[model samples]
Target: MKEGNVISERFLLNNERALRLFNGYAKDLPIIDYHNHLPPQEIAENKQFVNLTEIWLKGDHYKWRGMRTLGVDENLITGTASDKEKFMAWAEVVPSTIRNPLFHWTHMELKNPFGVNSFLNKDSAMSVYKHCNELLSQDEFSTQGLLNHYKVKMVGTTDDPCDDLKWHQQLLDSSFTAKVKPSFRPDKALMIEKTQQFKQYVQALSEVSGIQIKDIESLVAALKSRVEFFAAHGCSISDHGLAALPYSYVLTDAEKREFESFLKTDGSVYSNPDAFAGYILTELSKLYHEKGWVQQFHLGAIRNNNLGMFAKLGADAGYDSIGDYKHAERMSAFFGNLSLTDQLTKTIIYNLNPADNEVFAAMTGNFADGRMKGKMQFGSGWWFLDQKDGIEKQLNTLSNLGMVSNFVGMLTDSRSFLSYSRHEYFRRILCNLFGTEMENGQLPDDEEWMGKIISDICYYNAEAYFNLK
Candidate 1:
């Protein structure tokens, strides 16, 4: 186990007769990360990490969910437990997660950063913990170091209209090699039911744009101004998260007028959530068209309903679950509504449930005019499926039903820095799948052809699809 030893002959290019054919391309390539939740300010400032647990475990709901699944107490998770204690608790749960993607990602981080090969557990936790903490103190493991380690070329971070964009400005002004761009995510502003927060957001947007938003038209104007501000800072994409695609049977002008009236009277119009959400989506799409930006929709997440826990720990603390939405038909209607007008921008649809893989993969092709299969993309397997099995299934489904060659590759979809190991994990599984297919005579053995496929999935597809420089 040597430092910076990411690929191994035994595993990456395993000599096992069945897996050898997979090792055809470079292990490291420039990453065009089109989507993620990383704070733009941290990247802009080139922040230094403090410890292994703080960087890896804090604010990571995936690990938090796993810990809860193992029955580890909340104190060990989000409570006041010391970092070392939490690491020990996580180590105890590791062996049980043998076949889990966490097992692989944890070891990959350890091997790549600290050069430790020993399995992490009660016995080895202290040494591995201390070693990683020490390395993190050095210049090589800083935020920029991690991005360089993975060769990330560009990243689009989720941001709200209220954000000052100071951090984004910092990135543009910095000398760092990786490009950090802002992406407008206006979910909170649109979730008008959250009255206080929504009003605050409106005030912030009005202040930022210096335009008072008194009505729907003025609100739209303020948002457009913010989008232009974001674009000036290299934003070319906007993201929305919803439990399901909005299909409200086409609101009539009178109905839209009433909705606007409701907003003025009550400071909100979400009393009929579906219709309001649908109207907002349509308006947002129009904005996207005017700006010539990509629009991303991450659908099918069931969020917090556990009142007690939510009040205590706040949102995204492991209470969120997948939804059982009627995804295909609703998605069709949603797209159908967009198809009526040619205002649809380059779009990417991401689903949380794997059961919808065939549905989503099949859905993308119906919208693709064959002029470009990549234009309407089934986004990378997100949140719940941001793992090895999830990524492999997505690739296979896209390859079989749609054009895998045109698919954009991996995205962090994470709030943690160490989660970049996910890209490495995705690449390994991708290579193995292609290699196994080539070995089985299901695909060509030509390295040139295989390498092109590998590079497309790794970097080129995202670069070409997003028009990233």
Candidate 2:
């Protein structure tokens, strides 16, 4: 087999300025990964993988989706197949993922920590697997070691409201270098339509907070207690996953009473699930404002479409897709209400659909109070859009509609430690964009000014935005 690097040092650095900016400014900057699904227990325990599959393939829905696309069998993909078998199956599909970002990401990850530069395919599977597995056994490849290897200063793991956060506390107590802060993810709290899940969540929240959640008032009180509990644990960020921002008025006394009755006995879902969510979210945002936390909304995901597969594998198992939802009016109303009462806090909004890029970016400008730099953020391209085209469109849209300079940049939003390679991917693309513009004489050719802006978007802005410094 021919042997060579899959990606060179200048892979995405399209111009001299792009190369200069990436190497000098963006490459070595410490990462502030403010949002991800990294398991706190794995980080706290310093778990080491037995093989490449354990760390790389396990829980990686992106790869799983790609494998499924080429008609890979269920057993090899996610079933009772041996670890080696699944890794081999994924290797078989890598070459076929030519235009996909997974193709770039797979090669980038292989090159970075494992140093296996040759392209991964059926022919090279065993060799690549053995090489990476050998490296995974090292201390530097351990979970904490990987974070340190990438110079991750802080990681905000998505956590539920009812989460005990014992693992987070363990990280805080340990001699671990990176700050593993929890970001309060109360998505299930807004999912009242999932009757069984909602009830269980309320029970769990009550158990942890010692608050009896009998109605909307009690539920709000319970949520508030959890918010304070999370803040005590060094968490100053909150996240929500929604289809779209739902516009609704604050519940009246009569409506609150009606919701209380509905909570006592499940009946017809209390008029509108969205309205209940909006009311609760409004109340929660007020608490977020009071606590000075940054709130994030990842909107427009239509999840669990494949019910048969959903039953077999569950959510986040490569079954979700981008949702088409109108945003402008509802968002304006939602933020408008928060602004009216001075209850608005620093917020980041992520859109899954590329069509909503301009809408999401413009919405951020509507609520910027001038009290803080980039107080309202158009978040990084996320979920289905976490790739080259998505990132470019998001950046271009933000530049056209708002200030891209103050943008708090990229995040992993991934379950794998190897996903840190995405930061390099984003930085190279970012530098390329700016470099191309400079080469065209669209912007002034001052290295210092452009370099500082690059560094800020890559690291410093997020540092100040999340108060991580």
How well is each residue in 84-112 modelled by candidate 2, as lDDT tens digits? 99999999889899999999999999888
Would you list the clashing residue pairs of candidate 2?
none
**Model 1 over residues 1-469: C-alpha lDDT tens digits?**
2333333544544333224333445365787788888888778777788889988898988888888888999999999999989989998898877778777777776776567766777777787788889989988788888888878898889998878889889878878988888899988756666766777777788898898877666777888888888889899999999888766735566765765566467554445556666766788888787787889999999988678989999998888988888888888887778778876778999999999999999998878766665888988888888777788889989988999888788888888777776777777777777777777888887767877878787888788777775
- In candidate 1, where is summed lDDT lowest over 10 consecutive residues? 13-22
Kindly state the number of residue pairs that clash in model 2.
Answer: 0
TM-score per candidate:
0.93, 0.98
lDDT assessment of candidate 2 = 0.91
Candidate 1 clashes between residue pairs 3 or more apart in a chain or in different chains: 22-435
lDDT of model 2 at position 310: 97
| Winning candidate number (TM-score) | 2
lDDT of each: 0.79, 0.91
Best lDDT goes to which candidate? 2
